[model samples]
Target chain A: MVNLAVKIKDLELKNPVMTASGTSGFGEELADFYDVDKLGAILLKGTTLRNRDGNPYPRMAETASGMLNAVGLQNKGIDYFIENIYPRIKDYNTPLIVNVNGSTIEEYIEVTQRVNELDKIPAIELNISCPNVKEGGMLFGTSCASAETVTREVRKAYSKTLIVKLSPNVTDIAEIARAVESEGADSVSLVNTFLGMAIDAEKRIPLLSTITGGLSGPAIKPIALRMVWQVSRAVKIPVIGMGGIMNATDAIEFFLAGATAIQVGTAIFRDPFTPLQIIDGLEDYLNRHQIDDICKLVGALKY
Target chain B: MPSNRIRMKKNVGEFTIVSNSALNNTNYHICLQSDIGLPDIAPGQFTNVDIPNNKDIFLRRPFSFFDVDYEKKTVSLLVKILGRGSKSLTELKVGSKLNLVYPLGRGFTIPDKNDKVLAVGGGSGVAPILQLAKTAGSSPGQMHIAIGARSAEDHISIADYLQFAQFYFTTEDGSLGEKGFVTDHPIFHDLTQYNRIYACGPLPMMKAIAARAKEAEIFCEVSLENLMACGFGVCLCCIEPTVKGNLCVCTDGPVFNIKDLKW
Candidate 1:
């Protein structure tokens, strides 16, 4: 059997196929269609210190091969997550990574501190790159200074593996990646949703409630791969790559491009079983290539 | 809620076009019948129809289960050709094979016996309201339907409602019964007359009806047409913020009580 285990700092993923946050709701939602334990990891939806109502109606707008969402990071806050969601999902076999979003530096530390107390929660992904919310989402992620500050503060409060999620809507993504890594981030996930918008030509109005929204799907795959490649080369820490991963072939491309693990985001919306299918596909790919260890594929790109 | 995902069972149904009438300058109503056994589809539930012309519209366009004939295994649809995805749906031939994902979305709740129900619909939203009227019609004469459109031509023929209950129509251009909005119609002026209210349509229209029903403290439910990729709730795109928190519109409801919705 091909060894599929890959390590990201202290934590080890069964495979490189993990569900991206926001796309997969707490991992329990997809359990009906596919076995949740089959996935390498489940990145739960973005959680905040307080409950957020999110934006108004028409939060999603469909494009040619993709979709734009301005969901505004609506969640039941961190406390309810610990009390209601965690206890249930903790029973699942897959590693659980809580995606934390904060409006302020202190909020980030507070949520990370709470997550550090949970025994079942293996890691915390500090989401500094959400484009939909009005406050502190992509704001902290765009600038290197804010990104490092948030990562460093959370690193101080919590001892678990800290993954700083970076936004694609930046001048130099490598600068931000380096900033997070220098601030003691365990690893980094790159290429959060790209900012996009759609219009109803007839109505002469924007489709989403929020005029501009975060775009995700096959449309952004190439750009995501480029960012993942650049950031992987720039940082010493492991990189988790995600964008428009639809199948195993796409997952292999990310691994070849230097991602330690890959997250399936938009594809899950189309087929809930995609991540599991990807895991199985990766196994077949490794067996065919005669690669004994999957970790060898990390940053294997030749000059 | 337990994951409702199950192995998709394919069922083919044959349907004939009874009438293809132009509802407005742009929209058309293409009604059809099927020989195969049809599943139980509730109001607010929709069918994903595959269109032949455009390959880009890979996913089926979701249409509300406008009307159903169980004995004949037939279904009717009010198709408004708003885009290329919908325009392709209107061009189907009389004996065409239409692949459909039937009975998707949570339907409206049926009112208890002896309860007076007021059903409101606007634009293409009239489909489910009519279906609810048919479902509620078995009670003799307890169902009331109020439909609104921009003009008289925008209103689809509702001959099926003759046997159900009272029917009210409103058009903005004053071509039909009342020359105003559905809320402005004389029938809806007295919200206390109905024991329960059900509405679906444009967000603003549903919100207006919901507000009126709430002020009267009447039990009211609304079906939201949130943008959805997978009608099975996997997308997390069709989420509606409700009193119960964020719930999937495809699974938790296309149908939700007005009280539950934060709007």
Candidate 2:
């Protein structure tokens, strides 16, 4: 039998497959399609200290093999999530990780501090890297100093497993990964959608109201994999790799490239059953390769 | 209005195309037959049709539920060539099997038997309105459909609707039944006579209808179209900011009442 278990700091996942934040909202939509509890984990939507209405309409546009979105963390505050959303999803067997975000260091710290008290939530994925929002998202991620400072301050408040998701917009993602490691992040996930824009040439208007939005899907896979490889080697903590992972073959490539666990983002939109399919395929791959443990496949690249 | 028993569930199935024909320069009608029996699909509900021929469009293109023959297990769609994804779909031949995620989003409320209703449509938005005319169980006192296009050549024949509704037509050029837009047509001017209004069209047209419906104190529900990835609520990109909060157009509604809408 093939074992697909993996760990990041003190947290242990049943497998190395998870759904990315914002892509899978509270893990409820697909309840009719599949049993979401079967997956490794579910990263909830990005929540702020207060309510966020998000951006204006025309916030999304389709591209070749990908899409662009500027849905600026449009969730009812953490309180609404706890009162309305939490009780519903709390009973699922898998861990529910809250994706905490804000416009300032204090907001991030405060949100995480509150989430740390929720027993059902095993981890908080600190999102100092959302590109769609106007302020304090990618601003903290692109710069090593700011990234380190935010991680350091938030570390003081949150006691649970804290995974800092990194942005690929940085010049040297490895440097930013190293900085977060120094500030005591349990694990790091990369790469959130790359900043991109599309314009209707004839109409002379931008596709998204935000003008520039975060691009996700297969179009950004190669870049995400390269960054994940670099950051994985640079940091001691596990690196959660994502970007354009459509199926199992794509995810296995991430494991070979050193993503201890991989998150499925844009692919979820295409098929709600993809994550479960990947988990089954991952086991099939292990059986074919005669690898008894899935963890052995992590960073399995030959020198 | 239907009772609270409305549990709008969706299904994923493969459908075989029986015919594909152009209705106008931008619009086409494709008929599909599902081998297994079909489910109960309401007007304003939609199907996410997969364009397998195009490598670029990895996502499915959503079209409002055009018509469905439950006995024959055949469903139809009114597709308009809008972008690369839809352009590829219109080029597909008959007998091509397309994957469909069906009966998605909530449908429009069925009106009461004694109510006078105005159903407005524009461009490719005529499909769902036609379905409502055919299937809205309540036999309303009177129903009128006003469909608009750019020119007389752009207007498709809707003779099938004659039995269910008294229909009107308009074109930008004075070649069809009327000269101006649907709102400029006579039915909209007599909005006070109608008890309810249902519309689906371009954003500007629906917004204008919503404004008039509000002024006339008529109940209004508009089916919205947005750039959608998942026809379900997983991806929040299809959000419409309403009075309640940010609601996903895919699940909470492709159909929403005007009072609940922020527009």
Candidate 3:
């Protein structure tokens, strides 16, 4: 039998498929459709230090083979999640990871400290790559120094597995990945949505409220794969890859490119069962290839 | 007091198009039959339909259940051709398969047997308003429906609902029942007779009705068509600012009581 299990720091995942942050809201929406615990992990919506109302109307724009969103991390803050949301989701068998975001370094540290107290949550995906927000999101991720600084500060406050989610808007994503690794990040997830924009030619108006939003879906798969390969080679920590992973074939490509695990993002908006379908597909693929362990596929890409 | 409504479990089902026909110049009525049996759906709850074989339109379009037949396991949507995505939906061949997430969001509150309701609709908003009226199960005198469009050609014939409701029409060009908006109709002059008011349409139109309903101190709700990505709570793209901060239009409601709204 092929083993689908993988590890990042002390956290052990049953499988390598996870729902991308900001796509599955606390795992409640997809739970109604199927059992969410079957997947490797559930990355809850991006939670901030304070409640954010997010961008104005028209926060999304659909493009060819993909979509753009400027949701701006609209969560009810860390306190509400602890008191209201955490209690309900704490009992899930799957590892529930929080995608933590902040506009300031102290906010990031404070949020991390609070989440460290939650026994059920095994990890937090540090989000410094959100393109929709004006202040600290992409600003910290685009530069190597700031990425290293924020990782260092948050690392001191939290006591569990920390996966830093990187932005693709940079010229050298591998350099940024190395910078986060130097600061004590247990793992790194690559290629958060690319910074892109869409326009309505006839109306002479930008489609998204923020003018430019983070783009995700099939259109981003190739670039995300390239980044995952580059970052995986650059860092010693396990790399969790995600960008437009719609099916098992798409996910297999990431594993071959050096991703220990992958997350399903925009595809969930299209089909809620995508992650489950992928998990089944992975098993079938391994059996067909005569591979005993799924980890054998990671970084197995030939020149 | 705020309404205590329990959130219902949503379903993702594959349905086949049973019929696709035009209701007006701009609107088309497409009926889809579910491969599985129908779930417990309410009046204002909507469905997110995946437009097949179209690369340009990547996201699924959301529409309220225009009509649903449990016996036939079919749900209908009244689609207005706003863009390439919607226009493509109207042209789908019969028997084509479409995947959908159904019974999403909170629907309108079904009125008590003694309550009389006035249902107002404009543009694509006509779909949910019709569903609300059909589900009300009230006599002709107990239910009133007001529909407004730009011109006579924009209005769809609701002769089918004549047995269930006292219908009223208002077109901007004065080609239909009355000249101005639905609020200008004769029914607006006597809203005290209605114990409940429900609207689903353009922002200005619903706000006008909500204002009138507030003056009469009647319980009123309106369904909002905010721009959304995932037709579930996760996306947070379709949020409407209410008394309780920001609430997702896809989950907390596509339908919400007027008192909860800042407007």
Candidate 4:
């Protein structure tokens, strides 16, 4: 059988297909439709040191190919996640990665410290690029200095794999990628949602309650691919690519572009079975190509 | 709960067109029979309608589970044809096979058997409120329903609701029961008469009702119509900010107690 196992630093995934953070809630909600063990990993919802009440009404807007969201990191704090959500997810076969968010460096440390205490969680995905929240979200991810600071502080408390999820809203994504790597980030995931807005011309009102939101879906796929390629080339750490990944072909494209693994986000809304389909498709591809291992495809780009 | 990823079995139900009539020159009332067994559906719950005519709007349109005939397994809807998406839904045949995602959002709270309930619906919002009245019809307590439309022609099926509720009608053009809005009618002048107030329809109308109910110390709940993509919670497109935080309207609610709402 073709080996689909992939290793990123200290962590190993059965396959390169993982669910993106925020899109997949703590790994419990998706269990109704599919087996959780079939996934390579599940990135939990974005969490902070303290519980946050996200933005006001109208947090989502629909676009042509995808949708926009201003969910504002509405999640139970890290403590609640450990006490309540973790106990449920820990029993699953897939690796659980907590996506951490904070408005300040100290908050990141506090969250990471709490998460480090958890026995089942294997990694902490520092969501330095969430566009919906007002404070620590896109703000920290936009600047290299802030990214470095948060990554460094979390690295101190957290001994597990630290993945810095970068944003595409910046001028140079490579610079931020390098900054997080320098600060001891174990891996990086590129292309969180892009800042976008839609308006109703006739009514003279914004379509979403927040007026503007983070755009995610097939519309942002090309941009996400380009960013992943750029960031993957810029850093030595493993790159987890995401944004608008809908099918098996898209997942394969991310692998060719140098991502060790790919995350399915917006596609889950359109078709719930997309992740399983991609996994099966990837297996077929490996067997067809006579490739004995799936890891051989990771960063297998030819210049 | 872990997110369910498998495609649930598509339940094919048939809805006979009880009465397909026009409303406000733009909207239509296309009621159908839900022959297949519909599980427990709540007030804020919605159904995903299969638009057979078009490929452009491949995704099903989510409408509140307006009303249910549990014994008959039938549900009804008030469709407002605003664009190509809704226009295609109105074209669906009465006996045609319709795919629906039923009981989606959390339904309104069931009133206590001894308490009085008031349901206010305006525009297309009257559908769910009518459904709520039918759901709470068996209660020993009294139920009142107030419906507001722009004109006489804007009104739809009232015969069904009349049997279950103290129905009140309002039309802005003085063509119906009363010559004013539902808020203008004497029935709503004193909100304290009702133990709980439920409203849906236009945003401004619901807001106004909520404000009045809050002042009269009555518990109020409104079903919000935020733009939604997936009726399930995955898209994160139907979130409403509240004191408790940003919650998915599709999951946490299309129904929210006024106290939790920021507005």
Candidate 5:
């Protein structure tokens, strides 16, 4: 039998497949389609310290092979999440990981400290890489020093598996990964959406309300894979790769590129069943390749 | 008012195209048969339909449920050719397969048995307004529907609606009914007559109707058509600012009471 189980620090994942934060929305939406308990982990949507109105209407624009979004972490703050959302999702059989975000270091630390009290939530994916927000998000992730500093501060507040999600809108993602690793991050997830813009030629107006938003989908897989490969080699912690993973083959490519586990993001917008399909496909791939454990495929890319 | 049962679960499965008939140059009536049994779908609720075989269109397009048949396990949609996604959907064959995340969002609150109602619609928004009229189970003289379009040809046929409610129409070019917008019609001027007002159309038209309804102290609800990514609450792309703060148009509503809106 192919053992699909994997681990990140002390947190155990039943499979390498997981739903990316901001895409899954606390794993409630996908529960309508299939049992989310079958997946490795569920990353809740980006939660902030305070309720954010986010941007105005026209937040999404469809592009070639992908789409752009300027949602800007529009959550009801950590209090509402802890009171309303957390209680509902906390009991899901899979490990529930909160994708925590903030506009300031104090906000991030405070949000992290609050989540630390939730016993059901085994980990928190620190999001310093959101491109759509006007402040703090991508600003902290793009630089090595700030990435290290935020990771360092959040680390002190929370005592759990800390996965620092890195932004691709950087010159050296590998260096940023190492910086977070030095600050005591348990693991790192790579290639949060790349910054991009869309326009309407005839109307002479930008498509998205923000003018520019984060680009994600199949259009970004190759670049994300390369970053995952580079970061996985640079850090001792596990690398959760994600960007444009539509199906299992795309996920297998990430495993070959060095991702210990992978997250399905924008693809979930197209097909809600994609993460489950990927889990099944991974097992099929293992059976075909005569591999016993799925972990063997991680970083198996040959020169 | 018909108390809509809040259906917590949603489905994602393939539906085969039963038929695709053009109502006009810009609009098409497409019916889809579900592989799984049809769930109870309410008016103002929508579906995120996948536009397959089109590499250029990546995201699923959201459309309000125009008609649903439980016996046949089918749902029909009123698709207006707005962009590449809707245009691609109109070109699909009868046997084509479409995946959908369906019966999403809270629907309009059906009027009370004795309450008089008025529903206004235009463009892509006409779908749900028509559905609300047909299914409200109102007696004669209780339900009135007004539809507006830029020109005569832009308006789809509502011959099937005569049995359910009284119909009113207005065109910009004055080709079909009264001239100018639906608000220009006499039905909109007398807002006190309607116990509840429901609108689904362009923002300007709904806002105008909402203003009149508010002045007359009538309860009013309007369905919004926002650019959506995921048809569920997760994306938070389709948001409408209300008294409760920024609520997802996909979840908190594609349908909202005018009073709750900041507008």
Candidate 6:
């Protein structure tokens, strides 16, 4: 049997497949589609200190190979996740990681502190790199000092495994990954949606509520793979790779390049059963390659 | 709430188009039939029609339940050619298969037996309102439907719903039954008679009806046509800020009482 298990510091994932935050809001939406526990881990939607109204309507626009969304982190705050969402998903066998976001360092710490109290939650993905939000999302992720400060502060209160999801809208992603890693970030996932936008020529207006949005789907997959490869080489910690990963073959590319784990986003919207299918496909791929343990596939790329 | 949901099952079902014909200058009537029997659909519920063979339009387009023939295993959509997806849906040939996420979102509240209901449909909004009036089982006198379009040629033939509702028509150019908007019709002069007001259409049209419904103190529900990608609740793209909170237009409702809406 090919073992699909992977480790992010103290936490152990059954496989290397996890759901990207914002795409999977809690575990209930896709609960009807498949057994969500079959996933390596569930990265819950980005939660903040207080409830956010998010951006205005017509928030999404479809483009070739991908779509743009300026959903603006519309969650019911950290308290709500602890009270309402945590109870419902706590029973699931898969690891539930809460992706925490905020406008400032304390706001980030507040969300991290609250999630740390939840016993079932094994990790917190510090979202210093959401491109859609106007303030404190990609703002924290764009710079080295801010990324380090947010990571260092949250790391102090939160003793569990910490994952900093990185933004791709930067000149040097490797530098930012190194910055967060220096601040005791257990691991880093790159790249979050690349900052992108679409416009309606006839209407002379931007397609999204926020003119620019994080572009995910097959459109960003190549760029994400490149960043993951770079960040994985730069940082000593495990690098979770995501971006435009649609199926099993695409996922194997991430493992080959150097990602310890991978998160399935945007594609899940099209097919909720993709994660399980990807997990199954990984097993088949490993068996086909005659690799007994999946770890052998990590960074196994030759030239 | 899951225990009491009207829809027993929801999925990506492959349905063959029995007919896809232009009903008017701007809209097309596409009827799809699935071999695997159709699910029970409530009014205001919609189908996310995947525009086949188009990589440009990656997301499925959300179309309200225009009509349904359960015994025939068919569901209908009133697609207005506004964007690439809707335009692509019109181009599909008969016998072409289209995948749809069926019975999506919360349908309208089934009105009381004795309640007098007025269903106002404007633009593509005519579909869901007509669906409700046709299958509502309300007596002819109790089911009042008013449909409005820019011009007479823009209105689709309503022969199918003739036996179901007491119909009214309006066009901006005055080529049809009336010369003004649906609200301008004499039928809406006295809103006190309508026990419930159900509307689905352009924002301005529904907002106008919402105001009148408020004045008359009649219970009103409006279906929103928010830009949606994923029909299921996965993507929070279709969120409508309501009294309860920021609820998904695809899940919490495509149908919501005027009271629950922030609009």
| Candidates in order, interface RMSD in Å | 4.4, 3.2, 3.2, 4.0, 2.7, 2.7
Local accuracy of candidate 4 as per-residue lDDT tens digits, A54-172: 77657766677777888788787988888887887799998999999999888888999998888778888999998887678889999998889888888889998899999999999
Name the better of 1 and 6 by lDDT: 6
TM-score of each: 0.82, 0.94, 0.96, 0.85, 0.97, 0.94
Compute the TM-score of each model's chain A versus the native chain A and list the values: 0.98, 0.99, 0.99, 0.98, 0.99, 0.99
Residue B116 C-alpha lDDT in model 3: 89
Comparing 2 with 5 on TM-score, the higher-scoring candidate is 5
Which candidate model has the greater DockQ, 1 or 2?
A: 2
lDDT of 3 by residue, A40-109 (tens): 9999999999988898878898887998998888988999999999999888889999999999999999
Q: Score the docking of each candidate (DockQ).
A: 0.25, 0.45, 0.55, 0.28, 0.59, 0.49
Q: Which pairs clash in the backbone of model 6?
A: none
Q: What is the C-alpha lDDT of each candidate?
A: 0.83, 0.88, 0.91, 0.80, 0.90, 0.88
Best by DockQ: 5
| Model 2: residues with Cα > 4 Å off, grouped in runs | B1-8, B35-37, B138-141
Q: Report model 4's chain A TM-score.
A: 0.98
Worst 10 residues of 4 chain A by lDDT: A26-35
Candidate 4 stretches with Cα past 4 Å from truth are A1-3, A32-34, A143-146, A200-212, A284-292, A300-303, B1-24, B29-37, B48-61, B69-76, B91-102, B139-141, B190-193, B228-247
Clashes of each: 3, 0, 0, 22, 1, 0
Error of 5 at B203 (Å): 1.5
Question: Could you tell me how far off, in angstroms, the CA of residue A16 lies in candidate 1 after the best superposition?
Answer: 1.7
Q: Please tell me how candidate 1 rates in CAPRI terms.
A: acceptable
TM-score of candidate 5 to 2 decimals:
0.97
Sort every candidate by lDDT, greatest first. 3, 5, 2, 6, 1, 4
Fraction of the reference Cα-Cα interface contacts (below 8 Å) that each candidate reproduces:
0.26, 0.51, 0.80, 0.31, 0.84, 0.59
lDDT per residue (tens digit) for residues B21-85 in model 3: 99889999999997667778899999998988777888889999999899998999999999888
